[model samples]
Target chain A: MTTITVATRPTEAPAGHRLRFMFADMITVTWRNLLALTRIPEALFFTTLQPIMFVLLFRYVFGGAIPIPGGIPYVDYMMPGIFVQAVMFGAVGTSVGLAEDLQKGLIERFRALPMARSAVLAGRTTADAVRNVFVVLIMTGVAFAVGFRINTTVVDYVLGAALLVAFAYSMSWGFAAIGLAAPNSETAQVMAFPILIPLTFASTAFVPIQALPGWLQVFARHQPVSVVINGARSLMVGGYYHSTSSLWYALLWIAALLIVLVPLGVWRYRKTS
Target chain B: MGANSSIAVDAHDLVKVFPRGHVRALDGVSLEVEAGTILGLLGPNGAGKTTAVRILSTIIGPDSGHATILGHDVVKEADTVRRIIGLAGQNAAVDDYLTGRENIRMVGRLSHMSWKSVGARADELLETFGLTDAGNRVLKTYSGGMRRRLDLAAALVAQPPILFLDEPTTGLDPQSRQDLWRVIEGLVAEGTTVLLTTQYLEEADRLARDIVVIDHGRVIAQGTPAQLKADLGTSVVSVTLADAGTAQRAAVLLAPLSAQPPLVEGATVDLTVDDGPKVAVEVLRSLDSAALSLAGLALREPSLDDVFLTLTGHKAEVANDGGTPA
Candidate 1:
């Protein structure tokens, strides 16, 4: 027969040790989510395939009709927006993942553990961000195949991609709150669609802000999604759409979202029944 | 009461109400579990058993009242309490996408075990749970019993002294349930204190050193299995008549033989008495004199099932759904 030992009395971890454990717990949880993602090939396939389909649909079907100002190629102008849109859509996975965990009782298990409470949400958002990175890389290859070119240096391109992923990560915290609040995965997806559709479509992800009506154009130009898309466009393409202010505005929005949503998500997680 | 250092889990007047339906899941419930023993929280479905376990395990804070694990407050010192307790909730609480080995290792890592210990412990747990062959396979491929075993194995990754099993064997087959019972008994033999919630009367009878019966979010009775059964009587003489009408007559005929009235369910009449063989002979003689033919007769000691029925006014196996919303 196998022998088991009784646990020793529990002692509180010191402050520095607690901090280190938090990071270690976050990494472990992150690895768990990513490992689950890899096992579900259909989920990965659909997430990446949806973006490629969007790229093909926009480049071949909508490219000729939509003209870019300053004679910039439509493919080049649209690719950056497509990259931002892909990651933004990918952020919804955070909501679905968290809701699924809650529904399947994994959240209860995690909450009962000695690990840091923030690790669950942090690990989830981080894993979704990593997935966004993979999706963006694949989109980059597809954009190149469709005659899209980066007019800027490799560093600028990388910066733009980083901005998109960071924005996606911040959005994930907001979706994390939604996921925890939702009762189940189906409802989480349903709740996310209304918020996501308006943000992506009303912004400059698919069309220019100038193409919209006057009243809508104001919102289109100033919205966080539009600001980030313009920031990415400025970094990668650098033409009429380029503005140094867009970068600052995008960073400001990301910071604001992270500040508000991180605590909000963690609070919702703590308050989850 | 002064601090009872030997109590592994102690709660005082716990109450919880789910805000959605305003269901009072737990109402002024209090219980304690002594270290190195199993306290079976026995109840029917939706009787707040899961809610009680949730509060004690630090999964959710009670609306009112407080609890402590190993003398540390569950709410104020949840992190400390978490370090010393493992909970296998009503659901498996395991990742369906991960392998059995990975699930154990993940929990070990989260429990803050060293990487080397995590690996060795994962192997040991898988072997102990009889999951060694399936350790490399993802959980999606496991059967219901394997998943439950893995869930329990994952819970023991840190070898927490206190364990809360909330209906751990609710839906398992007879074989699987017995296997789980043996495992739980082995753990307790090794000095692991367990707070087990179950609707299975036999489970409580076989595994629990003490029993607490809760219904409608309230504790109706509490004692050891024998004590609870003895509260009803020393023996249970069950007689199965040919029909419900005969059973009702048999109940009335046998009612005066014991302090408690006979429990009649359709064609079966069960009476609690101070003596088994003596009362059983009296019951058969009385039934025969009344000209009622007996289909079957059994004389045995009082069981938790009879205790639950006497206390709750319903059979223990009956599902009282939507009562507590647990």
Candidate 2:
């Protein structure tokens, strides 16, 4: 009964055809984001540039004042801490950009498209992870330039880098979820502060956990930020890798964050009524 | 793709209540659209046009209605329904950062076209929408009309059987509106069924083959333009003048010719008169006696606006673009 005058139009489909359509659509969304970012290479520059500057600044400016246990240099100790923050904060940029998209009604347009429900977020998180890798590499190079040498063998360094990148990649999902759930950009910033500040300051990101107050020390030791920094730092310091407990802790955080944020983000998307 | 289905879109008593019973956005509204013709949905603000469009497009669910787009259920089979329907909103749903070509290509990709096919379709749409020259330029630099055209082009990327236009020309200039109307005509000529919603009377008159007139979330009347106009009781004789009291005196003279009482509104005088042309001349003779400046006179059949005024005792609010949606 379809009186379609055109001879080359599709009229009916099966279930698998639609599922593949969603997958293909997500790949396009990912490419669209990357293409949009190509013009503003500044995000790439800032992500890398800001982290490099911080590592150098903290090393030359305050390295002499702060003493470390076992006399490990501040440059060597502070590099991993700054690296994690730089990458995590890099994710907040994606969150803010997501907030901007919401205001502009871009997200609504995507929802109207019968694409993969999670593809948009997945594409963003994937691209962000790549950005974090480049940013972390810059931070790592600068750390080495400032007399912060990795005492561990080459294999350990690779393992540590892999862990850090994985951690950063996983973190973007939470931030992406926040960007979608946040009512407005200002609220997004407000919400980010409480989550980032407590996680960053309470953990052994900048200093060792034993250096904090009694109540904070307990929290500092168990927090995900502490586990991540210790894990990355342990790989660089060959002597600390004997236990490898920090690596497991970091992985636990990654798994835990993915389980909580990904579904919540997807659920929020479904309710986009 | 239900290109083979005779019924492009069929719905029954679709009702959608937003924010519980306190707000009834769409109250028991339903209509069907045959394949290949443009079915224009005309109503003033809050007429449930957008709500019905949303329900049919599968963007939101109807509380008590069932709809099938090309044989796919709007709710239960949303993915299938979406595959056959394309929607372009009053506000341009485009990403400004991307180029027109890139935006359309992205939509093609989302619709599952291969990258090569996506790029090819993007170019085709860009040329058809008169945006080929601006294809490479970012949408941020495009004019308002170009952005809207590109938005429409993006919606058509999937080649959906049914197109949903929700006030497609709300803010466009006269020239741009005409351009969109042409594009819509082209769509229908190529066998695409359209469910267009608009608040502009002229747009509905120009585009809709069959008009569905809605008010306060219900269809007041549904018919062809001529049929709807004929249902307005009697022809209206409208007169425009340059000087004072011409319309007043004309109303007095035209009173006896009217099936209903004559009405004098501002500078123009209108009367729902029988055999309006015969009565229009009589009105002019009275105005000539007043020695008032004679500007112009128009005697014509009643329009949808007049029908709206006659039925509701007032025109529907023009700007019913509330924050709520169907």
Candidate 3:
């Protein structure tokens, strides 16, 4: 039998406490996610190692199979493209994690606590964005080791990094959306593949859209990946030819994603059914 | 309304309708827990117990109800309500990849405590739960009991005065469960007012000073365990299947225990009698004399099962775990 032992001390009566997510909450959530990632080395392998290997493989093996319109080595052409695709595909991991948490009812626990509703998603996205930075850096280093030199000035390099930063930020929203919406980890993975695989193959990552059939060329040119990659290539060429079209399209994609994702994430945040 | 402004938990017309308004998860439910009192909301699964817990805990907004914890409305002042209450849901809420100590520290940090305080509190809770030895172990490595205990400790990281625990000991082994029960009793002793929702009649019978029974979104009865059992009559004798023969043999052999015919469940037999334990012995002896193979037997007084069957028509069972009916 459970006995209710009454402690003699007067209870610490509650004041009119308004809930606030302290700075510590954000730090803790992010740190916890990082620690969790550390424990599961496999997540590290897929998010970091696989992308690094792909950048090398696609640059060497697949690069020779295709040619760039600018007459550069296909490695140079595809490296930027790989960067964008990896960020997009890596989102699947975030969604899968979200799905697992949902299945286990951890998200509901968070809602019940005093933490800010946005903090959970924000902390996760921020942690993941930090992770993406490492993935990009590793991939960049591998490209450099493979003799893919950038003829761009320091200013152009900074601009490219800035663009990558914004791209990663926007891409994280898309991934966060998938994570919050997909019902389970397996479903999330399945959903992510359709978005990532098609986005990769359809973009002008490996070759100039000119080589693609006239019908497929339209899609290749219009894809946000193609625009971002081209923008990056132009940036790499010492800012010689700047096309606002690619950057604008990338922004448009981000805006579109936020329009759909913010509400979805919020709905997922509050839903108990 | 109670004159005491310090009445910790106050809910009025706390109604919640789910599944597109088809089911009433909480129908005009109302409750008030004086500060520092451990009030147990007792009911079976699908009794709208968890639904009520979620609403009052601020996890879900009620459709047409008002709830307050420490003077904060659950809907209008949800953020404030959240600050005053800690909720441990039915499942283990710990992140399996993190160590138990890390999980506690993480929750403490989320409560906005200083790093030193959070760290100190983490160690304190770990010690309190007798988990100091296993604190560094990853949650997945811990047993079901350990995970559940960790969940309770996590909810306390914020140090909220009003705590809500929904079936906190559902799958724990007896010893681990006792350890958690001890922790909860200690919390209430230290002035924490808990709102516990549980199906374990023994739990409510022991820990709850006041028991509120809900079924189909409505509060059917509310009182102390003695009062409830006194009202419901006596406990029921239930026998589970030894192998896979179903509850037919038990039903046939224990027929005298029931006013009506013994219920032949898939793998168990259920019967209500004036003295369950005494009758169970007679039933077993009679069965053995008849050479009938016996499975497992349990002697329980008119439990929440009897209370449930008296109030509704059926007993609460595992098959109805997540099925919140209208």
Candidate 4:
């Protein structure tokens, strides 16, 4: 009997030895999603193409109609907001991907494995963040070609881009929760728009805060999306609207969202069918 | 050996009710699989087969009761049990965007294998499952059979001592199912304890040493294939007449030799008999004396279908949708 037990026993790790395993599992899952992105060029094409279209449509088509409040070019003024908007859209892709995995029963497969429970959600959001970074870089290049310039120092521009990516990464957790709650990817995509429309459209992403009605102006200026967009906009192109305090407020928003949504996503994932 | 040590999978009175509508997926289900043996969980669609597998594999917790794999509690020691079990779900849960080799490697890495050995094991599995030629192709481009094979390969990459397969061949072509059965046989030969849930009676008969049949979230019957058939007392005799018109008359003639009345369908007369060959010979002699020209005559042992029908009071195929027969 002892021999049978010895022969069949699974390899046991030392007490509390799973910390490194958790990191490894997370990285492996991240690597898998990233590999998938590379293999499916269409996913990359569509993700990159949408931002390019936004840059073009907002810059050329809506650029003439939209007025710049700070005497700045509409293109430069809108680029920060566009970057935040593009990154937000990119983050929604996380929800879609997660919902697709759930619908396809991939999550059940992951659950049957012995790896870290947090690895699947962590890896998914991390992969989308990495993809968001790439989209931001490509959009930056496109902005540069279209006469969009960073008026501030290079460090500030880099900081602004980093904050945008971080915000996008934080938002991915909220999307993860939505994905786990949603029945399918199509519903996730459709349902995300309602929540996103008020955030992006009502904020300072497209037009100036002054363009909105007086009642909506309060929310338009004070909302987290506006704070982050205005914060990134200040760091990239210095203007009277560039307030240093907004950056801290944006960071606080990102941190608060991560604190709330990470647990919610993981909890939802564990309870998912 | 102690009882727990001898039993690889020991589940007791597991009960799971879905929270939303309170759907009773498992109602006091219990069973055990001995070490290094095969146990087939037989059921129809929605008979809680997948739910039972999920609970035993620790993918989902049971609402009540307990289960253990290799003496490690599925809920309390889920991580340890997970390390020792491999599961191939009904959907063949391999990622579509990954190549067969990459899929195997990913599972190996998740199992905490070193990168070098993971690579080697991936190659070896790809070869073993006959996916070496298509190893580099993304799974979306592979055939359904190829994807199912890849899923099985991924599950086996870590060589877990216990395996749970939930309808592993549900959507597979016949040849692919045969190939998978052969691979599974090889795994059992290597001393892996397997608990497979399948709707196909033949699958259970061919692979499982012990079979447990569940329906409507309860165990309807369980035993070895032969024992189950004998318990049904369903040995049968069939005689085909040269004339379809004579079948009814033959049924009347054969009724006295059978335990129940004979059934005539087209040119054949079927008799429910206890001693098949003896009754078959008796029926033939009577039919010949009556000048009923015989085209064929045979005695047949009871099949799993008869056992299922007798126990459930309905044919297995009829009550197979996990509900009362339509």
Which portions of model 2 show Cα errors greater than 4 Å? A1-9, A17-23, A45-53, A60-63, A145-147, A240-243, B1-5, B20-22, B240-265, B278-297, B311-326
Question: Can you list the residue pairs that collide in candidate 4?
Answer: none
lDDT of 3 by residue, B1-326 (tens): 35767688888878877776588778898887878777788776777888888888877788887878777778888766766677887887889999999988877666556688878878877877778999999998998778887898888877777889998887666776677787888788778899998877667767888888787778888888778777765777777766446467557666766674565557877777777667878887877787767668887766665676666666654423332211
lDDT by residue (tens digit), candidate 2, A1-273: 111232224445555665566566666777877777776788678767766776766777866776667557777778778888887887776676677677776676676667776787877777677667777777777777888788878788777777777877776777776787788777775777778878876877777676788988888888877788888888866574334777788889888977887787677667765
Instruction: Give the TM-scores of the predictions, in the order they appear.
Output: 0.96, 0.87, 0.82, 0.92
Minimal lDDT window, size 10, model 4 chain B: B317-326
lDDT of 2 by residue, B1-326 (tens): 44546767787887878884566777878787778887888777776888888788877789897988877788888776666777887777788889999889887777666788778778778888888899999999998889889988998887887889888877677788888888888878888889998877777888888888777777778888888888765688888866446667666765776666665666787776657778878877876776666788897888777766665556545554331111
| Model 3 stretches with alpha carbons more than 4 Å out | A1-24, A237-264, A267-273, B1-6, B234-305, B318-326
What TM-score does structure 3 among the candidates reach? 0.82
Instruction: List the global CA lDDT of all models.
Output: 0.89, 0.75, 0.73, 0.85
| Tens digit of per-residue lDDT, candidate 1, span A65-184 | 876676788888888878887898789999999999999999899989999999999999999999999888988988999898888888899899999999999999999999999989
Off by over 4 Å in 1: A11-15, B1-3, B318-326
DockQ of 3: 0.31
Name the best candidate (by TM-score): 1
Q: Order candidates by lDDT, high to low.
A: 1, 4, 2, 3
Candidates ranked, most accurate by DockQ first:
1, 4, 2, 3
List model 1 lDDT by residue over B250-324, tens digit each: 888888998987899999989899888998888878988989999999988888889998999888763332111
lDDT (C-alpha) at residue B314 in model 4:
49
**Model 1 clashing residue pairs (backbone):** none
Per-residue lDDT over A25-99 for candidate 3, one digit per residue giving the tens place of the 0 to 100 score: 666677888889889877766776666777778866776777556556666667777777667665566777777
* Candidate whose lDDT is highest: 1
- By the TM-score metric, which is better: model 3 or model 4? 4
